[model samples]
Target: MSDVFDYIVVGGGSGGAVMAGRLSEDAGTRVCLLEAGGRGDHPLVRTPMGTVALLRTRLHNWGFETVPQAGLNGRRGYQPRGKGLGGSSAINAMIYVRGHRSDYDGWAAMGATGWSWDEVLPYFKLSEHNERLQGPLHGQGGPLWVADSRTGNPLHQRFMQAAQQAGFALNDDFNGERMEGLGAYQLTQKNGERWSAARAYLLPHIGRRPNLQVHTGAQVLRVLFEARRAVGVELLQGGHRRQLRARREVLLCAGALQTPQLLMLSGIGPQAELARLGLPVLQHLPGVGRNLHDHPDFVFAYELPTLDAVGFTLGGGLRMAREAWHYLRQRRGMLTSNFAECGGFVSSRPGLVAPDLQLHFLVALMEDHGRRLHRAHGVSCHVCLLRPHSRGTLTLRSADPLAAPLIDPAFLSDPRDLDDLVAGFKLTRRLMQAPAMAAGVRREVFTAGIETDEQIRAVLRARTDTVYHPVGTCRMGRDDGAVVDPHLRVRGVHGLRVVDASVMPAVVSGNTNAPTIMIAEKAVDLILGRSRAHGASMPAPVGAGADVPA
Candidate 1:
């Protein structure tokens, strides 16, 4: 590997992969990407349904956990992060939603400069190769492949019918026009398999560019700095630890959780917290782990008389067994389906401008993957109160570099979050009871048939978990204690930047993968001295709009 490069990107996840590929495009600059996990050589990751193979596997995932949530009946939530090349994008459900325009507008209203809808459209368009969007809002010439899932299940149709029965218009596209109805999800897939960032962005440029180097299984321990300016990284590679320099810049794309952990480990975080950890304060960045937030998701399930060909269910084992046999023989049947085949988005109440909540329709029933929900005969329509009102956080439990940090996304810490979720549950229940699904869909089998709001709240507290999208740990802004600047430069430190989801001042209303990629693309432009058009024709971010601030 080259001793120095024009830029060093850490973490070969979704954003990191894209950044490395995009930044190395000109060939005028050399770039090296480092990942804590191994190469993207696994066969399971290539399949759409192969997420199950990588979900719990250490080969491509870091199974982290949060401290007990005070709002969720004191239950701890399970956090799953991608450990390999593509990061969580390699293990995600692959749903591709760009989120709402207001989400961007809200960012502009906040202090996050140039992140308004108008300003962000180019970046989204740049990362997207859309099949339908043929306009100014979206572009077709991009590396990331965006298309509908090839395989469609009839159960999904029935679910959509149910959603319509609940009075939601059949939205053909959530990423287009308005994002306030139920529809089939567009995925980040090409051909028939999962199109991971590593496959789409990294691997294509790995061997062709000699200046670009990729080092996998290289765990970064901390950022090396001199008088607060980050100059290099200390890493553990091949069983031995070493320090590597970045002649120009060191980028952190290690994601929300690890990015904060690394920052705190490197002595950059809240002063009091660092004092407790007995670490010297390299930088008194209070926001290193503050404003930690995530969407707390809940699943409502049903038991159907007829079994599905490809829904995730424990009781459907016999049918899945037959389906698995068929898949092995001809690559067909239920085994080939991703459990979340169809879904919808809508406002929980009437008269809302955009969708306040997002729902995912499913043919199979899913219990808690966090602590394992009991398998029963049914289907589930998962609904997440995406535009949550609550915010929690991530902080270092100990200073040990090898130890996992204490993450408490104080799930539903705010009462408003509960109210919104309750409204969503009522809407979801209405959808489930719709005439469209009356024949195929069954009764609500999961919630113990509870009726009262208090009971519903109790159930939600017990069942609500993360949809796995976490951001805003290492927030970017012009604030005094912010970890990174608007250009993604680390505060109080030069030659270093955190370029992952953690930099989002706030979480986007939709899934975070796309926004994270957009951040990387925009960050590259900033590093290359190109105009990002930030603060141009856009408003600033809002009140602790303290959301995907980056």
Candidate 2:
């Protein structure tokens, strides 16, 4: 491989894969992608049930932990980011959600020009190939496949039924016209197997494109610069140090947590902090590690009879053996379950403009991001505040590039966020108590006798953590506090950009994977100067920015 290229994309996750894949489409330009982990096509990543194992292990995951959070009674929160080529998409739940339309509109409102719902809707459609749904909203024949879950488990249906019985509306498509009701989620899958960003964009074109070179296990130490322009990157591979140059640009898609850390390590951050660490400051952008926030989530777990749901009992073990065979033959069964099979969006109060709380219903008991295990059959539901008012920061632990960043989400620091979570607990408890789901209930594992608001608040303070949607460390906007511009370019640097969830001005109202993919799709156009022409026009979203169906 050559030492120089037209573009160098760091991190082969959702955004980096798309950037490299799209940039290499022009045969004249050379593109290189660097990933810190191995090829993400492991059997554990391909199987849908592999996510449960992936959460607790570092095999394909960067099992990162936060600095002790005062919100959760001073417990460190778990953050599992995907390693390898597919990034988090390889290890995530595979739920395909584009957040609310207002999320994009809100971005534009925050000075991220050309990022309104209508402006960015075309990119969302451009990256999707939905097998079931078709319309102006969904796309066909795209690289990323979006389809319904193959799990025929009735528990998912029962959860939705219980939601309906609790007086919530049924939303067939969360990514369609509206995103505010109880229903099953569409996944990023192909014929019941995991279809990650690597599979969709980078994998098939690896050897096919002579200009595209992908390197795994390449840990980038820092961005190489000439004066102010980002020229290349210094990386560590096989215990050897090397430098690769980018003739056109260097893109950072290392995700929210690591992206900011990289920026700081590269001498582009708060000047005082950078100088305090004995690192030279190239740009004094205070927003490099500021505005860090995430979905503060609390799970309500229940122990139920070992029926169709998965458990650790002898019968469940025997059933899982049968399921393995069933999955091997037909690619359909309990093994195909994403665990978070059912969920929806709802408002905690009457006056909210959009659904403020999102839910993820699981068929098995989960605690601490599946790190804690139980021996009984169970069900779990997660309720997370969609947009948190409280913010935190991501800072360097030391000058060492390999050291993990000190991540402080400062969850629930804003009392209103805690208030909303308390309301969500009450609301979720109601759904669990409904006749459809109530009959199967054995015992509430977490909140058994929690009744009053004060009790709910206390439980929330003890158990609240992240739903794995951390964002906004490298915020995108036109203000000085913004780390990147509306075009995703670094504020004071040339030939550099950030094209990942880190650039989101605020966390969206749903799972972040799909939106991260959409960001890359649009960023490709921006890099090619074809932004004005590529998918720039489409029918306006139905009731754009309006409240979802009640």
Candidate 3:
């Protein structure tokens, strides 16, 4: 309640909200959470399909875009970051995935001594409350809700049928023991409303917790350090600069893009880059904004008659009125759908550890993101490199916190990554033209007309874009190039922790919201000296210069 608190968390996004909620549980500990954006009060943000309305809502979103990527023939990649209480989780498609077990095990093997699949699984299980069956892999009483798809488009069922006919086994659970098949995806929703991190964790506790203070519309300018120790945070509050002290630690949950930018603003990054920003270098950690990765997808669409009651486009105006009646009267209809409906996981090539490509089936057939209406009735199949090989960086463009950081996703930068993408496109095409999809589909619109590899490559070169999953900016590692240690603590900086997607050592093979939440959940256990009884494996301290898992 005072100027100084036990913990000062920066950014009230997916991870920060979880940390603030969990760590503030102790009556003796005081927590302060600062969010740059306004409260998530926008009506669109709360609606089940509010992302469309929120996409162009700049007041509630950062809406950053990447620099012209040479790999994409000098095209700028669009980025939609949530600028509200829930952060991107509020605007995301709401898919829930824990990534592969080997993802964490590899962290342990990389010098992050205690992190393994076995250790992290408990934390994952502990954070989720699956609406359906509860088992060893799932926990029932968790704060976060993982609900099954309440409604499915007819096209979704057909996509599965096509996958089944194409020889890939059908899998109803991508987060189960096996993640290498096609099936319906579980979303982070309850009924038809999105249960974002802020809504599930922070909101319920804010009213009753006296020790926790959440400050919205507060932009952190820098982390205050004394003798290389993070002691507090300096922020702009209500047009007035206010300095808030943190007695124990300053946690950075500013997401992947902005966390490193904040650190650099406080003089913790490449010496040359810092010097260019006119900042006094506190530490020369070159990896502060490096190792950025994401999943880039290329979409395929086919024209449909738009007559089926169970398919998309049927939810427009007249149908919307009918659906509104159903939802208002009984809470049923297309209003419950996430729209990017059902999808599956598949391997782009053989000999890989897990599925390398993820497919998203959508009934809407717009060729580009946030674009004009489709010329005709249609649906689309989006498939791309699940875990791309290309890497990029985000660097400070100016010393001012208001200045946007320079983002370079470098999509399809690697020739190998492009090759994998081409393979993925080929496979998706096979599924679309198969008997299952052909049953009621009239004709192909987007790529249905393309027959050769050259034509398909042209489509990808012009339109392949990100699936909105970005990670690895502040990678955890034993190497000097890594920005953070295995426990998500920043290297060369004491009492400062990076608690978001930024600390991911590598990009998970799917949507990032779930893993980001898992990171925060596991970090809470570590801070409390507790480990999840099931999936969270905590490691002992490793040498600073040795390998570490984050």
* Highest lDDT against the true fold, candidate: 2
> For model 2, how does the per-residue alpha-carbon lDDT over 453-538 read when each residue is reduced to its tens digit?
88999999999998999999988887889998877888877888899999999999999999999999988887665653263443
* Candidate 1: stretches off by over 4 Å: 56-59, 307-336, 370-377, 440-443, 531-550
TM-score of each: 0.92, 0.96, 0.94
CA-lDDT, candidates in order? 0.77, 0.91, 0.81
Give the number of the best model, judged by TM-score. Answer: 2
lDDT of 3 by residue, 420-452 (tens): 888998888888877988776776766656767
Q: For model 1, what is the error of residue 358's alpha carbon versus the real structure, in angstroms, after optimal superposition?
A: 0.5
Total colliding residue pairs, candidate 2: 0
Q: Find the 10 residues in a row with the least total lDDT in model 1.
A: 541-550
Q: Candidate 2: where are CA atoms >4 Å away?
A: 531-550
* Cα lDDT tens digits for candidate 1, 15-110: 899889888887788888889987865777776667765664565888898999899988888888998888988888888887888877876665
